[model samples]
Target: ALVLEMKSLLGALGSSWALAFLCSTRWDWLRHSVLCTGRWHQVRRSVISFRRSWPGKIIMKGSSREWSGTMGQHNMLRFRAGQVDPMSRRLGNLLNMLMLGGQWDRRYYSCTVVVPENVMKDAQRVGRWVSRDDINTMGLLRHNWGESALADRYYPGLYKKLEEYHGVDFHESVMCWHIATDLILAKEEKEKEDFAADKRVQTVRALSNYMMFLLVNRPYMLPGLPQNWLYKQTCNNLDKICNDYDLVGSLGDSLWTVLKKLLGLHHHRVLESSGLEKKLADLIMKLPKEHASSFSETPRLLYARSVAVIILESGVVDKVRLLLDLWMDFLAYAANRCIRESHAQKLSTGGELVTIVWLILEHLRYLKEDPNQQHGHV
Candidate 1:
């Protein structure tokens, strides 16, 4: 074994000198050949060593490629399959954001998983993220009953609004989806070199995409909310808000971005400069009074408040992790709301964001089974 190993090592040497050295009998030729042979091995080893240590050589190719601004369905499928996990920071961190949502700490805020206190009391741990008692959780009740019983308790105004409008408050999810798509556009257009590494950017990107997936494809599980593509409309408004300021190619991947987004003052000068406000009023005026009245009063801040609330407790001045976690948990709730078949149908067409999230949740042992799942199961 040792003899074979030695021979193999010597064979790896790229040298005619080593061959000559072994067979030569002349003293000077032998010495010169030996010297050249040893140097050959050293040079060969050094080149091999350098290749191993070269960071550029090892950088994942996917990260180097232009990010898919659309977060296309196929991309979602690959990301969920784990083939892209090691190579794609954008998808991986976004996945982590969903998985670690309430548990992650930004020093100011932490993501919290909520169960109705009554359910938690009776709950016995089952799956890692879920338990036996939580079968009748928020979304299922909303699905079966066509309205979340707990909605009015926790979000009365939103609940009342949904009651009247007959939908849920996922405007934020759709909002995030728009922000993420723009970030992808920003990344591709060379808007920011650090866009992929920026967690705050990734958080909005992931949350928004996942939420929009719910709003678009899984409306029934969203308690069949009847918002008129409010999510899609807000995406247009968000893009306009930035374009009004020529910030489309310059969306900052930072902690307080939500504040900049939601605050009317940030877009104040731009709105005045562009006369977008008056134009918006003109458009709103054309709608029927009831529809116009309920349509967003401040298109600029439509989903900004939703983003703001997700990140509010995160010590916005300090860190983005807490905010990321909150959005993750928020999206996770959306991911968990469906029966298996709804996921399959949407997944077949373009892929659903919630399916990936739910798989990861179940894989990571964080899922709590929806108690009402039996009734909704196909």
Candidate 2:
């Protein structure tokens, strides 16, 4: 194996050197002006020695034509510029990158698998059923019961609102849903149910925060032109609301303190979460009777608050079920619409949940469309 590897390495080096020599010979001015000098021959020998090394082998593995073409161009430029060492230096740097690029640790990312408290408490058969049937845990399927249920019985106006949010602008939709989800989660804290332990509730919260995080930090990963103005405007208005109501720690708190509260620090969660939601709820209540014109400037945020109120009117179980449906749909929607390059870029850093979801959806779609899949037994 080692002998074969060595033979291949020598073959590649010999080919590259031969290509380089041919190109150099064709360029008469480069040969006469640069190569004939005694010092130039020494430099050429040094470059060839460097090329014989393993890193050089990797560099030589690239397109010989491109490498030679680039080398000739750089040679002319360096000759004109009266800088001979920089071409070799630049080549060394390229070789270094090729050698070192794969050595760095890549952070791997994965979505958390949520097991509902009931699933944990129940028998394995029941757990298996939930795993197979639950959209929140599994993801949207071709014949999802939740999808059918929502299509059949959900409010037409709410469905229209969702369509509006999506069709008009995706970033706006994400912000709207994120705000509503946050408010709803805060509201649920007051209920008898243990929200922190509920799998669906946690899933809703995770995806909501994640979408917002992408909007703020990784806008390129999301679809559409990022609505920077909308995000900034909404944030400023929320700050004003917090300031007016003193919903943060105190009236005299520093900017950082207020920001910490806004971000929901572990210590400030109870205080800030409830206070902010109450203020937002009150603000939603105070909007003018004419809903269309009242909050025209910051409409999505207010509209989201209103949506949260409507969702809240349902029974706790129904409300949670409704929210779970909405968030899962949102997750799938974002995944489907996101560009391929964004997903590819995330691979070098850490992978994203949305990219994974996108892959799953694409695979499922392929399976659904396959001619052979229809006849397969379970």
Report the number of the highest-TM-score candidate.
2
Looking at candidate 1, what is the lDDT of residue 70? 25
TM-score of each: 0.34, 0.50
TM-score of 1: 0.34
What local lDDT score does residue 335 receive in model 1, on the 0 to 100 scale? Answer: 53
lDDT tens digits by residue: candidate 2, 45-92:
554565546432444333222212100000111111111133322433
Q: List candidate 2 segments past 4 Å from native.
A: 1-150, 153-158, 161-167, 193-196, 250-294, 314-317, 368-378
For residue 149, give model 2's deviation from the true position in Å: 8.3
The sequence of per-residue lDDT tens digits that candidate 1 reaches over residues 1-378 is 785565345444533444465546468765565555676557555544543464322322122212212221111111122221233324335646788421211111111111223222111211322322433534231232212322344334443432322223554434443342332323232434653465454444444343444444345544335464454355345334333433312222244633332231122111011123222322322334344333365342323333333323323342233333334445455556556676665553334445555554444343335654323221
**Candidate lDDT (C-alpha), each:** 0.36, 0.48
